[model samples]
Target: MTSEAAQYWENRYRERGRTWSGRVNAALEREVNGVAPGSALDLGCGEGGDALWLAHNGWSVTAVDIAPSAIAIGAAAQQPGDDIEWVVADLAEWQPPRRYDLVTASFLHSYVELPREEILRRAATAVASDGLLLIVGHAGVPHWAAHTPHEGEVVELPSPDEMLEALRLEPAEWTVLTKALVERPVTAPDGSAGTIDDSVLMLRRNPAVS
Candidate 1:
């Protein structure tokens, strides 16, 4: 991440004072609950909710984010004996030292210019053989999003199939475990409850092929 990009996120995090809910993401919780515990890497780990949850569930986790303040907050929240490593780095330029059993990027959309597709492709390569790569992105705005800042924005979100194409994983080598738009309830900007579609893509690499 450039200094300017880091600064922007730092300021945003400071201003928001907990931009996201501390609870684990519903999609992640549901998906991981059925899988075996293993090493996991969480990209764009805002406040470490998913990282902490993975640790508690017996997985060794490496949580990363571009903002130092956000990483600091997550580090401070760490408990003793928790198997987690907090890292502050730009996911766009980061190279994983080793492959992980699970690589996840949850709602990694950024207002700033970023090589989002390339970053996600790199994340896919970091998944160990027979391991999982899970990417979650917004399918569209909820019905109650009229009052939000995103109301007028032209958000071009890709589908799970598009993500699979970006990953460039061979059909014979990777199994698409889940590819669909799942609905998740959320509190709208106006305090009204609404549902949003979560574009979920989960693929498992074939050990034999890898």
Candidate 2:
């Protein structure tokens, strides 16, 4: 992405005191609850909710986002002993330095021009052998967004099947743990309670693949 992308997000964060709920994503929290903690990577880690949750749950976390203000808010909220490495970098140009046992890209959507498919493919590749990859995203335009006009563009989100196909993982190398659309409750912009579909894909790399 260009500087416009970064500027757009930076302004969003700066304009709003806190844009997101300071809690781990619902899907991620449920899926990873019983798993053993390990090194984790959080792509597009705005405000670092998921990353902070992982760190508190014993997972070493690397949280990366394009907005420095968002990263700073999350960093400032950190408790002592939280093992989190916060990075401010655009996911379009950012590369993971090492493999991670668990990788998460929750709501990696953007209003600006974004290479969504390519970024997701790279995220899948960063998983180590026997590692897990989890992606959660809006399945379609939310009712609120559809009813109301919004600034910037509303990027169309892909279905779970489309996301899996885009990743192009070798059949023999990955196990599909989850591929489904789940409804999550949320408060709309007008403060009305509602639900939205979230395309969820969770995969585990087969162990000992050479």
Candidate 3:
């Protein structure tokens, strides 16, 4: 089943000609720029835009996605200075070989079920002490009246409280540096111009207790 999903995403990227904007997320750029350079992981890194940006900014990046075609496109777009390791694997099953100073999961939340909490927990575990975890996704339904009747799968965008509860990270170990809704111009699937509300969480991991 996982293989099939990966194939599906790969086919979609192949057919559509593009899956991402080929640039880093605007919110991420602002937040990550000030942090010290360290090992970084880009989860669900479609087309590796974010990973490439991280590499250019002095981070050693590991980019992972379920779509093989996305990974291929990302690799092809890699520049000479971009040091990124692109991996084709599902996050539900794949585990990192080592911890990182920064972990980023962006815009991939809508694809999972109840297992998301566990996945996020694992993401937190992969962060080293004094590291950071950044999770950004759509805040809610694109619009109240926007409807895709045939697409039976309903995407539930997690609220700030829900995300905090799901991760279950201890307060003393980490802090929610930022959690807010941001409105940005977006093109909807129907080719209509609209806006998207993105929910962003930036958590800073505290140094481990001696």
Q: What local distance difference test score does each model get?
A: 0.86, 0.92, 0.83
How do these models rank on TM-score, best leading?
2, 1, 3
Residue pairs in clash, model 1: none
Write the residue-wise lDDT of candidate 1 on 1-210 in tens digits: 266667779899988877777778888998778799999999999999899889888999999999988888787788887899999998778898899999999988866666788889899889999899989999887786554445433455889888778887778878888999999888877788878899899889899832
**lDDT per residue (tens digit) for residues 1-210 in model 2:** 448899999999999979988899999998899899999999999998999999999999999999999999999989999999999998988999999999999998877888988999999989999999999998876566655437767776889999999998898999999999999888878888878899999999999835
Runs in model 1 lying further than 4 Å from the true structure? 147-154
- My TM-score estimates for the predictions, one after another, are 0.92, 0.94, 0.89
Off by over 4 Å in 2: 146-152
For 148-169, candidate 3 gives per-residue lDDT tens digits of: 6456465668876777778988
Better of 1 and 2 by TM-score: 2
Runs of candidate 3 exceeding 4 Å displacement = 111-114, 141-152, 187-193
Best by TM-score: 2
Clashes of each: 0, 0, 0
